[model samples]
Structures are given as C-alpha cells and as structure tokens.
Target chain A: MKKLLLSGMLAAALFFAGCDGTSDPALPPSSDFTVTFKALYDGQTLEKFKSYDYDTYKVNFSRFNTFLSDITLLKGNEEIKISDIEWVDFTPDSAFGNLTVSVPVKFKNVPDGDYTGIRIGYGVKPELNAKRPNNFQSTHPLSRENEYWLGWGSYIFNKVEGKADLDNSGAFGTSLVYHCGSDAVYRTYTFNTPIQVEQGAAATVEFDLKKLFTINGSWFDMKIPANQFTSNDVGNVIVATILMDNFDAATTVIQ
Target chain B: MKKNNAGWTFKISTFSAVLLIFLMLDACKKDDPPVEDRDDDLVAIPYNPKSYTIPKPEIFPEVPVPPDNPVTVDGIQLGRRLFYDPILSADSTQSCATCHLSSGSFTDNKDVSTGIDGIAGRRSSMSLLNVAYVSRPLFWDGRSPSLEDQALRPVEDPIEMHNTWANVLDKLKTHASYPAYFRQAFGITSRKQITKELAAKAIAQFERILISSGNSKFDRYLAGDPDALDDEELDGKLMFFDEGGLLGLPDAQCFHCHGGITNTGFSFFNNGLDSVASLNDFKDKGRGEVTGNINDNGRFATPTLRNVALSAPYMHDGRFNTLEDVVEHYSKNGKGVSNEDPLIRQLGFPIPGTNPVKYSGLTEYQKKAIVKFLHTLTDIDFVNNPDINNPF
Candidate 1:
C-alpha cells in the first residue's frame, strides 16, 4: 500500500509538472459569454397576476416555465454547445407584486469571436427525455417530480398556467392551463441573429407569452373550453402543436 | 544505546519546517484528505463513525447532504439523546420531543406549541418527517435555510425551548456522557471544543435520517400490488393523482401542491386560507414578514403529508382538527384572496348550484374518497421506528 501510494503521488506530481506554466501552450483569449432570458408579455416586461388584453378578451398568467437544452452558438457550421438541459421559471415569485423575477443564466469560457446566429433545442431533448426523474440526482433540473407527467411518460417541457377572462367583466375566472410535453412536440429552432462574443459581452433571449397563443397575427380562438392540452385528444394535440410552432416567433435575441 | 537527539522540540521544528515548505510550494498540487486546521489539543478517541445514507426507494430522489456534515450512526445516536434530554430547555421541563412526539408523527397534535414558560407560540409545531428534502429557506415563513440552522432557532426562540446556547453548551461540556459521545461522533479532542454549530450538525444528522419506510398502502398499490387498496381507496388514488381517464372522475387537484413521492412539492403557496382585501390585510403575513414583500404576505411552505393521518390539526396555524376539515377547506376553493395561487380557486369540480360565484367544488363522496386516499399515505413503521425514537 505504501509503494502504491508513493507511485500515485509521484505520477500526479510529474503529470502536473508537465503542464506547468512554463510548458503552457498558446491559445486564443477566451471570455465568458453570458446568455440571459427575459420574460415579456406582448412587448413589455411581464407582470405576473396582471390582466393583459388578448385581442378582445383578457388573460393573466401566473406561471410560465420551459426547459432548454443543446443551446449552441452557430458560426457558419462550427457549432459550440453552450448549455445542456436547463429549467427557467419566469413566474414572478408570489412575494413581489412589483419585483421582476427575471434572473440571467451565465456560461463560462468562450473564445472571442463573431457568430451569425444561435440554435436552441426546446425542452429536454430526446436522449434526456427518455429517462425519468429518479434517473438523475435530486439537484438536477430534470429531477423535479412535479414537472414530470406519468401519463405522458415525458417531462412537461413547458407549463403556462393562468386564467382567461371569458368575458370583459374583469373576472379572470376561466382557467387557462397549457402543459405542453411529450417527445413528439419537442422543437429545435435556429435564430439567424447577429452575436459577438468578447470580454464581458452579454446577450439576452426574450420570450413574449402572448405571442405563443397568437399564431400568425390571430388570437387563440376560444372555441373550446378551458384546460387546453389536458389529454391526448387530437384537438389537444393540434393546440399543443400550434403553441410549439409559434415558439420561434415569440422568441427574440437581443445582443 | 543513545537517544539519537530526536527530542520533542526537534520533532516540532521538523513539522513546522515541512508545513512552511509545503505552503511555499504553491505550484505543487496535493489532494485534500486530512481535513484542514485540526486542533492538536483535543484528545483522540475511536471516531470510526459508521457513515449512514438515508434509505429511500429508487423512485424517490435522494436528499442532498451538506458536504460538511455527513450523517453517521454515532452522530444520530447522540442527536437522539440530545433531542430527548431536557438539558436543552431553560426549566429542564421540556425537550425537542416535548412538542415533536413520535406518536404524533413528530408533531404535538396541538393548535399552538407552548414553551418552557407556558406561553403558546403563534404557529403550530411542524412535522419533521422528510424535512431534509425541503427547499431553501426552511420553516413556514421560509425564515431559516438548512436543518442545522432550523435546529438552532427553537433553543433561542422565546416561545419554544427558550434557552440560551451559552447555557446549553456549558451543560454539554460538563455533562456526564455528552463529551465522550461528541468525541465518538465528531472526534472532538476536548469538551471545550463543543459549540452550538457542532450540536446543530449532530441534530440535523438525526433529523435527516427520519425518512419514511415507504411501505404505505399507496406505495404498495403503485408498486403493482393489486390487493393493496380497497375500491374506494383505488378511486381516491385515481382522483388524487388525476389518472382517471374514460371513467371521468373529477380532478380533486390535491396533487398540485401536495404531489411527488413524499406528498409535497416543497414550495410556498397562498392556499387562500383567508379572505383578505389586500395582501397586507393578512394577520400572519407569513413569508412576507421574512421577505418584506407584500405580495408574499399569506404564502406558506407546503408540509409533507407522509403521515398525514398521524399529523392532525393541519396547516401552519392548526386551523383544522381532522383530515375531513382539511379536505373541506380545499373543496371550498379557499377564501378568494387575489394573491392566492391562480390554481387554488380552480378545484376542477363541477358545480350544481352556485352558492359561491368564484368556482365550483367537489361532491360529498369525492371528498370522502380523497380523505380515504390520504389515509393510505400513513406509514405505521415510521412512527414505530426504534432508530428514530428518543434514546433517553
């Protein structure tokens, strides 16, 4: 045991000495590229529990959360994966009526460069979605048991919960819940926007929850009852598909 | 034979020289194994404390242990002794077990907990089951952060244990058996090394191991035991979990906040216990007082329902006596406070005639069935576990 311990220590010392400062190689200067997400309603910063106009009717959302994975910055075809699966909750905490609950997600170590655009794989991508909550450590984002749906065998990739004012009588009584999940509804969108990564360079991705329901400049027709995407019904699937499709339109990159 | 001149001063000088050189060689990397700044004065005893891992089913996620305070068998035993000993109380009339009894599932089954001075606290005693899994900022108002911190508060709180840590430390330092126990648990060299921080750590270790055995009827049913639940219980389980498909069972929506394997989401919510005109109107101002945010006025942390049957008089204030009253509160869809969670008012039950205009509620039988399902969550083994009992 003494010989083994000595040998191990010797090897580690030699290995570290080999990579010492004198033997360091020249590399491009790197900087931390911080990518933050801001929550918006229509175009303004989102205020939780406040009513917003939806064409004719009004709506107020209490919760908005989504999972993003395989976030890559694209320069021509040279892609650099910035993040794996991450959970973002835009819902302002119940304590702050005036406090904006938006927090930025920061990534470290990116070579200084210019990029044409960025790509984001929305939701837990297929490989991760295949596993359940217990598969990961409790600290992992996917281990949130409440976010997983046993019936769907998938994580509820995005949860939009609130009440819709069916009539303009100021009572947002009608519940509006759209828990979109399942592998079939996962989307990967590429936004061709300008991005420059330098020292202390920062960028943000803004998402307006209103635009999700308003597809192609039209309101989400309230032809059906509340609780959209409550089941695997074809109508619900179509509604979920519409919501997923408009994710790109609802999102904008601010550099 | 000669002594070879290797005296105590020479040995100390060699150690000091080696330490100085090791410190000066900043580029040389060495793995951290022997913990830093260990006291040389403390007498060494057998400190081979058996490391303990919280036993949880694979379906239930493992609770994170703080890197500094790992759970150990000797530590838990010491904590259990401290938990039951009245040496922590001001009057020597109470211990942590006075309010958090094992039969009551770690609660005193009282509306408000009385302290050593016979003064009742405003809030009810909370159950400590599965408390290690709780999120940041522990307590109903989210005041303390970790179990170690929470264990430290009640000792100083005027309405609970009502004793100073100074007094408690002095007693432990001079106690008949505690110093030896601490040495066995934490490898402390002397009784003088004992501090409130180490005491809190040992208590936290004991609390973390207070996990459920996970053999409840609900657990068995989910584990594919067909005979685990009765007809009503099965219906209640389906309604509670919202799994009833073509059968068209009403969504009880109990699982919204009270979901997960431990029957809790560990998040704060305004379940609308009161009908306040504004957020500030709440008498308690639960999380608001801690955060100084008016919107968070009435919100409280969701406690685990692992042994709900044993933990009676529920909620932060012990407003309800029976499980029926608790279920009834949810069925009524809260008091309609604006800051109340948006989903709180949405019980998803059908209304026959509108006595209240806000939202409809569950039927009579559905409410009973849901209560029955809650009963299946009771783990008799947890209450009777000898490992968690008071060592005294």
Candidate 2:
C-alpha cells in the first residue's frame, strides 16, 4: 500500500511539472498588425523578338534570392538571429518586370519601445546556420544541391530574365543573374522606418523593387562577359558593391 | 535475565551479517558495464610497429576528418581490405588499387582510367595526395563534395566497377571473410548487413589513411633545417614568393591561382583550352553542367602542382606530356579567346621587328625557375613509405 501511494504521488508531480513547462510564458494580450516583404527587379523589356527553344544555351540564371528571414521588435541593438524566424518559400515568375513578395509577421515578447529599421541579407548568415549532418538521408535543398558543397550554389537566389541587344538587330536576348553571395555576388539592406509596436502591438515594412533598379543608373548592363565572375572582375565588383551598399533600404513603395 | 539478553544480541548480529551480503551483491550489479560501453574485442591485430608505422604530420590536423567518420584503426583496416578486394567490381577483376596504385601517386599512368568490360573513361585520374585539404569538391566538374561521396562513384559507375548496390551487398554477404570483418568493424552482426552507406564510410576511412605531404626538402627547410635545399632551389623559391621580382612578370601571375602554402586554390577557370575553334562541340561541358550557369562553361578546377614533377600527363585534358610542354602552354598565354579568363595576360616577348604573339610575358628563364621551385613541393617520405601500400 505504501509503495503504491509513493508511486502515485511521484507520477502526479511529474504531470503537473510537464504541464507548467508547456504553458507559454512569452505570449501576451493579442493585438493585430501586418508586415509585408517585396521583391524588386529591373523594368527593362525586349519587344519584337520571336521566342525560340530554350535548350540551346547552357548557362541560365535567375535573380538573387537574398533576405532569408526578417524579425521585428528585437531588443535594443539586438542582432536578428536566423533561428528566430521561419522562412517562406519563394518561387520564380518573370512575366512581370518585378516580383513583389509580402509575408505577414507576428511579434512576441515586445517591451514598450520605438522600433526602427529591418535588417536583411542575401542568405542566412554563416554564424547562425544549422550544421548539416554529413549524411545522404537528410534532404534539405542546400544539401541536395552538390554545387553548394563546392562553396557555391547551382541556382541564384533570384533571377532577372530579358532579351539583350547583342547583335544590334534588337533581337538576340540574354538573361542577367544578380544573386550575390560568396564568390558570386552579395546583397544586404537596412530599412529607414522607425516603427513602434507598444507592449502588445505590431508594425509593417513594405518593400518596392522598381526604385532599387534605378538607384544607380539603369545602364549598368546585366549581361556579364563569359566566365568572369571573380572578385577582381570590374563589372562584377561594380554590381556587387552597389547592391551590397544600397539596394534594400532604397525601395519606393507603390501601394 | 542476562542469558535472555545475550540471545537477543546474537539474533541482531545475524541480521546485520545478512544485510551486509545483500549490499555487496547490489554494488556488484550496479558496477557491471553496459553492453555498449564494454571494450570491443574486434580490434585489428596490430602489425609490427615497425612494419606499420603511422607517419605523423609536423602540422596537427594533418588529415581532415568528416566530423562524422573519425579515424579508427578498425575502420581503416576494414577500408584497406575493401580497397584492395576486387569483390567491389561486378567481375571481380578491378580493385580501387588497380587504378589508384600506391606507387603512382594514387593515379594510374593511363591517360584516362579504364573500367570493367574494357571501357575507357573520359578524363585522366587525379592524384589523391592532400585531397583532405582540398577546399572544394572533387573531380574536374566539382561534383562530389565530401570524400565519402567521392569514394562511392567509381564503384557503381557503369564504366568503372560496373556493379549495382544490391549485387555488391549480396557479394559481401556471400563472402566468407568480408561478413566477419564488417561485423567486427561496424558491430553489425548479420551477414546481409552490407549497405551502400557503410561501403562509402569504410572506403573513405581508407582514403583518409592515404594522406601524405611530408619529408620534402622544402618541408625540411620550413622545419628550420637551413641546409636542406641547394642554392639554385633557394633562388627559385625567392622568385616564386617575392611579390616584386616574380609577381612582376605578367605570366608570373601564377600566384593568383597557385598562391599560399598549399600552392593551389581549388577554383575552376576556362584557361583558354576551350577557346579552340571547335569549342562549341566540346564534349565535357565543365562547370556549366554542374551550375547550369552559362558563365561557368569550359571551366575546370585547378590541379595542385605539389608533385607535378612526378605525376605526369598534366591538366584536365592531359594534353601536355612534359613539364616543359605545360610551361610552354602557359608561356603562349594558353590559346586565348572570348571565353578565356581575363587573368591570362600576354606572355611572349616584344620583338625587334614584329609583335611576338601577345602572351603571358613569361621570359624563358623565369618559367624554368618557377618549374624548378615546383620540384621542392614533393614529399619523399610519402612516395617511399611502405606502410601506405595495400597490404592485402
């Protein structure tokens, strides 16, 4: 009888402890707010050209898919960690000049303070990256792409496709890939808005892509000369420097 | 009353004796080792210490380990057996050692490795020396990233071993000795336990054992032996690293790709080889096929010049037979054209009457000196060491 009583008491204690552990200490009174992300592109076009079969040219690339994730309402001077935010999937569609992307964000554990600016980058920062087990079974996109093993990637984060005026017929077309990271290209942006999401509220930052393309002159041609994407390559460095320094925060909202 | 009290004391003493025996038995039970924690009896019979010497590196972390497959004596022995055993092949005619011979810098002398059924491979075999330090993936196209992934390709490849995964597993299970070895090494008891994953791990473990870049005259000099290198070799060394004297030669821009102590950065470039008039018809698409990016076409990873003097038939195509031929290829600024990298500068001398075909500006003497310096990178101990040979 004594043993049964002791076991029963222990089981009850453990159950209560587990229940208390799960009750979220972070959630506060729910208040509503909206957040949106936007993708930008060059507004150039190539008209009066007949479309041809796509298999001839081997090298095809898309735009830079930078900005892995975004988090808001962080503590004063707190760096955003990639683990804190979940990523949204980005599929490419080049029918329009620009790809506008927006994801609503929810904030938790907010202290009463004014929040200014959102930080973003080309990919998850190396420091916060999860270690991939060196096995074949785990099938993450980064792991499956063997190119990623060679310190580079097979696809650009984003892609910009257009026709090039190479032969002067205004006919021959080429695609430009501006995705940046590592030995390729890198993109980073900081926002200008100082938002305040009081003890129980949220805020939004809207991104517009058209303004970014015209920041430097639009004549910065995207067609890279064949096999020259090194650090010292003049055109590559110029594009990389411009994108890294001032593309994200320079957005002009359309809506 | 006293006699009654003595009887009571005797009973208490007997009870204490029983309790002490119980405590001892309980303690022994608690001390028993868990099955997983016990020492494994399957340790490889250590060969004579002299016969199987482990060549220690002057620099620690000499061989890079895939954080998962650590260096274990058992694993390496198992891998060595697997490496030499032709059972990996469908016909059991070719072992890994058949192509990657220990005496030949881990590469066969053939222009391209031959596989089962007399099929010829496309490219020449690369030396496996210092593969652990390779920054990028292996192969001309930068295919497999890790050694484990790289080790499995030739086995199941149609032109190579010509074996399927299921058949290979069956072969190992049927083998009288291999099953026991696998069980001993991996603690997997079943005869049908061989899997592709385990095969890769074992082969990689053996490949990791092949690391060698020690005992060269240059290494001795670096180790503070002032008398190791002759005066001419020392002069060559000076011209190689002196950014002003060597780096001044336009073609001496060898430092850009072959820079730092490793003497080679694992980067791919077109190198003007693809600039041949018929380049559009070239069969090997190079980095473009891997990346699907147009910019990377005709590009191949730079091979290390460590044992260049010994490992002959150089480059991805293996067209240049001798070191002098290779030097001359670079001397002519490498058949420059549109897809050629910008780093390929003009090489030929400015002639008195007419323009020497614009080249990498490498004077004949400078090229010779650079080649001489490359000889210093060879590690004699690695080449001569008997312990690294396939014991089976």
Candidate 3:
C-alpha cells in the first residue's frame, strides 16, 4: 500500500513537470548591436559631396549606395545571423544624417554570445535579386527609383556617382559613375576578428573606405577605359568585378 | 468501510475532472464554425474565367507582364472594343484607332497626330509593334512608368482626347454593353465599380497583344534560314550589328543603341539634333522636362526600328521625312551640341569641299546596305494580324 501511494505521488509530480515543460520554453537572453560604416578618402573621413584629390585627379561624389545583407556573426562553428538585408546610402542627400555620416544600423535580438568573425553579403540575397523593383513594395530598398534597369532586368546593387578631373585640371570634367549590378557581381566579405557581446550591451563594426577603393595599395582610377559608366557593356561588367573584388579585399572588422 | 468510502470519493473526483476537460474541449471546438458556414453571407455567382496564353515567337525574349494584370481573353476583348470606341474622347469622332492605323504598324503616318479638336500634338505617334517588350520609360520624353500609366494620359490630355476621366467613366457606365464587358473582364458586381484604373488595365492588356511579325528577314536569318537575306542585306546586317570588328569594317556604332533582336534598347540619349549652347537652351527639353535634370536635356528615348520603314516621318518631332534623310543626319555625326552623347563625336567622313566630318563611319555603299537591312525589319504579317484588329 505504501509503495502504491509513493508511485501515485511520483506520477502526479511527473505529469505536472511535463505540463510545465510544454507551457513555455526558456529563450536565450539577447542584446542589440550597432554596426557603423564610414566612407573615406585615403584613410581620412570624407565630407559628403566634397571634392578630394587622389593620384593627379580631383573627385567629388554625388551619390554612393550599396546593399549590405545577410550580416552574420560567427564563433568557431556556430553562426548567428544579425540582419536579413539593409541598404547603406552614403549620399549626403540621404535622410539619415549623424554628423557627416548616415545613421548606423542597429540590430536587435542578437543572442548574447562571443563572436570571432563577421560576414556581410555585398549585394542582395539571391531569391530577392531575381525579382525586379516593381515586384517589391514601393518602400523597400530595392524599389528605389532608377536603381533597377528594367531593360537589363537586373538591380543596380551599388550606385557610386561622382565627377572626376581626368586631366588633373583641378576642375571636375568627366562623370565618374559606377552603377554595378548583375547576380554575377555579387560578393560576400568575411572578416576574421574577435568580438564579444554581453546582454544589453552593443557592439560596433566599421568598414574602411580607403581599402575598398584600393587594389594592392594603388587607388582604382575611375577614368580607366574599363571603369567608365555604362548600363550594358563589357566595360561595366569589368568595373563591377573589380569593385566587388576590392570590396572583399579591403573590408576589415573593427576590433 | 472507511477505505471503501475513500475509494468512492476518488472515483467521483476523477469522473468530475474528466467531464470538466471534455466541456473545455467542446467549447474550443465550438469557437470555430465550419468553413462553409463561416462564409454563408457571401453569394455564390457562376464564373467561367477565360485564360489567354501569349504565343511565344522564335528568338524573341519572354514578354513582360505585370503581376497584378495577367492577360485574359475577356479582358483583351474588352480592351479591343474600348480601343476602337470613340467614347473615350470628348467627341465621338476620334478613337485610339483613329491615330494608330493597323496599316501603318499602329502609328499614324502624319508627322504629328491630330486630336479630336483638330489640334496637332507635339510628338508623332509611336509604333505599337512589340511595345510590350519595352522595359524602359514610356513615351519620347521617358514619362509614365508603365503601359497602364501611359494609357490613362491620352484620354485626359487636352491636346489629344480632350476628355475628362469623370466624363469618360460616366459614358462607360451608361453604355449598353460596357458594364457587362467590365463585369466579364474583372468580375465586378456593379457598373458603379467600373473605374478608370480598370479601364487603363484593360487598355494595357490590348496594347500588350500587339507584337512584331516573327517572320521578319532578320528573324528568319536568326532562325537558321541562310538564304533568308541576300548578300547586300547580309553585309548590311554585319555593319548594323558591328561592335568594331564584325566584318573587319570600321564600327558604324549603330548597335551601341540599336542592338539585340529587338533592334533598339530602352534608353534616352541626345543624338545631337540641336546644338544648344547650354542645357537650358534646349527648346524641347525632351526627357529633361520629365526628370527635371539639366543633363538629360534634349535626350529622347530610342525608338525600335522594327517597322521603321512604315512609320515615317522620323525623329521625335518627325523632322526626317525619309529614311535617307535620317541616315544622312546620323552620317553627319550630329551638330556638336553641348550635351551630345560622347559616342556621337566625329566619325571621320571626309567632305569634298569642307573639313572632314564626323559621319557614321559608313561609305555611301555601306549606308545603302544599312538602309536595305532596315527594310528587312519590316514585318507585313504583324500589321494584318486579325486578332489585333478593330472589334467593331
């Protein structure tokens, strides 16, 4: 009789425990992190739309917009995706202005953990890339007017606009516009640097603009025959390839 | 006896607990009614929706269709009727077909189209042949986002239809067969639901049905017919498609703007028609007016040469009356305008009495060949397609 009573008590306890387990699973504590980006001219922070001298040429940028997507945080074999997709506009005319630079992107619900690296896709995700701007919501980043070339049936992933003094006359003469797109030009950059985040604390990541425009320590000349602005041409493709390669090579995680 | 009483008490408690749980589950089930009963208020109406599948031509790219406005047989029929009806105009004398004649490849041969009020428009009517494939901005000025948006403007433009949307809608609502046509096309319950948006969508559907003749000499050549074009036409084809070295000839730079099977890309460029001192000096402003950009001044969208042989007078203002004149203008390499396309600079055509001019890098014989090649793009079958003709 004592054994029967004890077994009954134990079964009741087990039933209550099972009910509690199914009611609500505990979620890992998370925090927010802000990733900041800055445009530079030869390692110096840039003033928006201002002309800067480089290698016998004076350049002034009017627009610079890029798609930074699928930002992932890595620690050994484990990975945590922080952002699905975000458009970073470096144009001075952009709405978000924090000092000279636009507002930094803040990611929420990042699980508190130690990260050893960061990865950023320089273009749109493949699934979304296949669709035209008309297919997306009007307010979506991909739906920005003039970003998608309907004739090419592709989105312009990166739009860098400027004028350059090709002859070094101190006057901007030639248009320096590089509108890079096409799925063939998409690239992902990974930075292997240690970063840690505690619950409720924010972490920051910085991208160096000087490195992005340089190759093997030499600045990429916008006036090169293959780097000129074109919507549909082999030259545009070459310029896009060089730009993506430079992005992957020059990107570094801020410690 | 006390043990028996305790056992009975436990049984009664367990029975009550089971009954309570059953009642709770029963209540949950009652919360959601059957799917059929939930929508009892909605009336069921019989609908036989007809499907339309556009014919795919050989060597042609897939037609672009807006997601919200898929082609339908009923919709196309309604659109055809609406297109031919003069009810869209303030006066009953002018219809879309009035300006766009099937014999002229859906373009009026007039330099500028005459409106219902006998007023002439600024730009000539553009050919509708293969217009559905245009991915760039619509109209010569690159205004309007899509064919649907383009359809809405002609009715209200004071220079064209000279009618208001409100008046047009009223006319459509009062028409004997229009409300029924609208119902058949869009499944609207009442004539009151007929709107300008739906009308535009229907008209766009009809416009999209106008495609090029797939049996053009160039298309036939692409489709493995070696004998389709003669040697002169073939040489012209090479010159037209040349990107510096097709036949070891100097690049005429024709294909830079008019390449691909469509023979024209969708982009606006100032081909140097006017020599303006500054961008503000351009009289027409063309694309610049629409975009409000100074650099785009005098830039006009490139028109397809598919039925160019038929749709003349040429250029945005219909300045070139003949194909020879058009070719000559290009051969002159355009008067050096401030914002002229970089590609439009001198092509080294030596003038007998004057300085070497920037021509189209084509000899007289080569220009003749290019003109012959332009003729092969004319498709006789497209202008006579029975399905695209007037329904009335």
Candidate 4:
C-alpha cells in the first residue's frame, strides 16, 4: 500500500511537470466585437388618451418571462452562447409599480467569431418550466427573498398588460402591468442589419419602456376594461408577439 | 570449561530476550483493527463517523424569524410538543403529527393529505425533512415564500387544521400547559404576545430543526468512503451523472432536474401530467395565475430528491406511485402539450433505435441503476431519529 501511494504520487508529479513544461496556460484571449439585439414592442395605443396623472401605469404584458433556460448571442443568422445573463427588476417604490426588469448579459469566454445580429430570450425551456408556482422568489410576495421582491414570472418571450380605450370611451385609469409567460407567447424577428461579436466577451440590448406603447403609429392611452388580466386571453398572446418583434428591432450592436 | 559455559549462557540469554521483544511488538500492533476493516462485510450499514454525535441545526434560505422569534432550547422543546399535540386543531382530535409523522418521512403516506373534518386537500402533503436547506420557493406551486408564512396557510385553510388565528391564539392562551410554555419561549404571558404570528414563528423554528441532509450512503461515497456503496450502486451513480441515459434515454437525465448535493433544483416543471385533460382541470393554475400567462398553466415546483427513495407518490399531483413510474413518465417526452418545452423534445439516450423517440434515450438496466443510486440518499439516522418524533 505504501509503495502504491508513493508510486501514484510520483507518476502524478511527473505528468503535471511534463504538461507544465510543454503546454501554455489557457488564459482566455480578449478581442473586440459588437453584439446587437432589437428591443421590440407593439404599436398598440393606450385606452384613455392624454392622461399621465397616476404615479404608476399597469401594463398587462403577455406572460413572456418564463421558460428561459439560457440566453444566446445571435450574430446575423448564427447563434452564440453566452453563459451569464442576470435579470434584475427595477421598482420605483415599495408597491412594486413600473417593473423594469433588466437582463445583464455578458459573453465571457467566447473566441473571436462574428458576422451580424444578436438574439436573446427570457425564461428556461418547457420541461423545466412546467408544473410550477407563480412568483419568482418564493410562493408569496411577503415570503419572497429580500433581493427577489419584484418576483420573476415564468412565461417567456411576450408581455401583454396595458389599459386601452376602445373607440374613445373617455374613462381614464392607470396601469403598468406587463404579463409575459410561456403559452403561445412567442416571436422571431429577422433584423435588417446584422451584428458582430467576438469571443471572451458580451454585450446587452436594453429595451425602452416608453417606446413600446408609441411604436405602431399610436399612443398608449389609459382605460380599464371589465376583466382583470386573466391567464387565458388571446389578446395577451398578440401583445407578447409584438414585444418580441420590438426587441428584435431595438437591438444595437455594441462595439 | 567454565569460561565456555559462561559464553554459551550469555548467547542463550540474548536470543530469548530478542524473541520476547518481537512478541511484545506483535501484541501491541494487534490492539485494534480499523472500524471499516472489521465491518467491511456489513451491507447497508452506513460509514457513520465515529465523531458524529449531536444533530446540528440546518440553516435554510427561506423560513424567516422576526428578531424576537429566535430559536432557543425552550422554544424548540415547546414547538416540538405543540407539533405532536392535537390541541392546535379545532376538536383536539388530530395533531400535526397525524399527517406529519416522523416514520413516514414527515409526510402523511397518502396520495392526498387529509385535514381537519376529514377534508381532502388539493395536493399531497410534502415531507418536511431537509426543508431548511431549500433555496427554492415553497409549496407545490411555489406560493408562500417562507416556512413561517407556509405554516400559517395549512392552519387557516378550511380543509387543513380548520382553526383560524383568532381561535388558535385564544385556545393557546387558555391552555394550562401551552401558556407556561409560551411564556418560557417568548418573554410574555399575555394573549397578545401568543398571537398566531408567534405560533407560526415557533413552528417554523422547530421545522428548521428537522434537517435531514446527513451521512447517507451516497454522501459517504461522495465524502471519499471507498466502500460506502456496492459495485452496482456505484455504477448507477456514474450513469446518473453521465449524460448517457440509464433506462430509457442514453443517460439517466435524473441529474438534470434532481441535481446538486441536496438533489432537486427547486425549479418548477410540468412533467406531462396536466396534458391529459383540460389545462385548468387541476386545482393549481401553476405560475399562470401569478403571471396571468396562459403558457405557465400546468407548472409546479420541483420537490427535493433527498430521501426520495422513501418519499413515494412522486410529482405535484402524486400521480406517479413509484420512482420507476416517475422515470417512465419523463422517458416519453412529457404528455405532448402544445407549446411543450423544446428541452422535453430533446430527451434521448445514447443507444440508438431502442424506443425510436428522439429525446428519451435510456436502457432498461440503466434506469434500474439510477434508481439504485437514489436509494443511497436515504439517511437512516433521520428515519430513526428520537428527537424529531413526538416529544409530548
């Protein structure tokens, strides 16, 4: 046993020494490249026109936050895998109004290879996302972790929550909810301009919230409908698709 | 002649002394064999640490306590008594131990848990073991963030304990034994101090003591015990870790959902259970109700796989009665739902042309091996613990 131990140690030492003498240290080489992805939104109008009186607007985005297993870096037509994409929710106050969720993506350990474009999605995959409870941190808002108070919704790729005035009803209400989840909430955007990216780095695509309401030749008005945004609305699906489109266009290649 | 006789006697004395010394040395060397060497043939007897004595309190991510509700010896003692006592119930006929028995892995061994008045709950009662180390959200739907918050839900639910906070507090305040215990745990004797909030905190503190992640067979092997597991068990562990499916797929993808040292990612998943009928047929709307997203309709939180060998009737609905059944469910790309996750579509084993299903690639024996590895997670100490049992 003593001989075996000694021989094993000697063999390991020799093997390590040989490798150290022959092979160079594998430090990731840095390079410069631009990564871009569009921040798309629907050109849908708000309900009651010319009303910004409320402190918070609840935009009912279709559930697009779930089913996100990984986020990728798309260059032109090719997809590049980036390991680090941390999404943070921005709350104006304790009431959790105006949820500004940001996904900070870094392309760490990628080698120089690029052409055009960028693509990223929210949430994991289906087999993972299924059979779950709502709310990000814990089961209840009060029980949630201090850092995860904003709660991570499970639906991926679409958000649909906002007040809209149908044919000028003239009743004003405030809403800022944007629900995005898995079911039928999907979109694919082909960018006009292709973006480039290199290895060992990453870039982010930040979508502007205000532009999401005003993009399609109309302004987002505030008006409440009879129904509180329920789980199975087809309109939520449309809203989710438009957001995916907006994101695809809003992506700017970072150099 | 006398000189020759003296030399011969000296030589004989030296030889006898050398032999005596050798015998003594051999006797000292045989004092005690290693504990492992003596019990090398013992099967299923864990490589228990000789140093292990007391059960350490496990620290978990969620179960919060107000600065006032810190865990103490008196508090744990009082909570353990209360947990075993039926006084917390409306009729005083059933206690927390009725459903959460220690022998049944802290879960009532039934498909669905029965509450006060024999009311059936929407879901099965989950095991309370190792809950302290859980970083994932609580409950089947991931609702109710902390254990303190979760404790109150079962109490208030009409189907559960059937006792409201107002009544529960009043009962505890009036009880002869409970008031004194409460006074020791909390520094107050008044009914206001013994509110439902205090009850939740005390119960949560006690639940935190029910930590189970200890020296299991698998843990022993991982901790470098060469003889912790038999050959077959070791092979199963290797197959479970490797991407090659064990039974149906190329590698037992059990590691994917049930990963990490504790096992189970605490993530939510739909394992094709809800696709049988209408999406809303189940009571839980999953993440959909919370996010108001239709896509999250059938999702539920993944339970910890620690002690999974003992905790049967797996899945959120408790539909799969056995571990093998659960494996079979995942083998087929979970009941095909429209917008079924792409990851489910990708399940497959290394060996080709077994099932012809692209994703689920495992062999029959590999599945059994993976199951064998899972059995090693059972900690006998936890199963036979005297402290976590009925203190009252």
lDDT of 1: 0.79
Number of colliding residue pairs in model 1: 3
Q: Which one wins by DockQ: 3 or 4? A: 4
Model 4 stretches with alpha carbons more than 4 Å out: A1-100, A103-255, B1-69, B242-249, B276-284, B289-291, B339-342, B345-347, B350-357
Deviation in Å, model 2, residue B225 alpha carbon: 5.9
Model 1's CAPRI class?
acceptable
Best-performing candidate as measured by lDDT: 1
Pitting candidate 2 against candidate 3, the one with the higher lDDT is: 3
- Candidate 2 vs candidate 3: which has greater TM-score? 3
Q: Evaluated with DockQ, which candidate comes out highest?
A: 1
TM-score of chain A considered alone, across all candidate predictions: 0.85, 0.51, 0.80, 0.49
Candidate 1 displacement at residue B194 in angstroms: 1.6
User: Which stretch of 10 consecutive residues in model 2 chain A shows the poorest summed lDDT?
Assistant: A144-153
Candidate 3 lDDT by residue in tens digits, A192-255: 8777766445444444455667778888866564354543432347777887778876555674
Off by over 4 Å in 1: A1-31, A51-53, A56-58, A91-98, A110-112, A164-172, A221-224, A227-239, B1-42, B346-360
Alpha carbon lDDT of each predicted model: 0.79, 0.54, 0.72, 0.53
lDDT of 2 by residue, B170-267 (tens): 88766767766666566664555567778778888777766555577776775678888776566556555432232343324454455434454456
For residues B1-392, write the lDDT of model 3, one tens digit per residue.
89999999999999999999999999988997643234321223333558786664645655667889988988999999988899999987788888888888888888889898888889988888777877668898878889999999999999899999999998987787887788788887667778999999999999998877688887788778999999888777766654224244444556645645666555677887997777799889998788676766798888888888998988888999988777767765555554465456443232334312213356787778778988999888888789999888
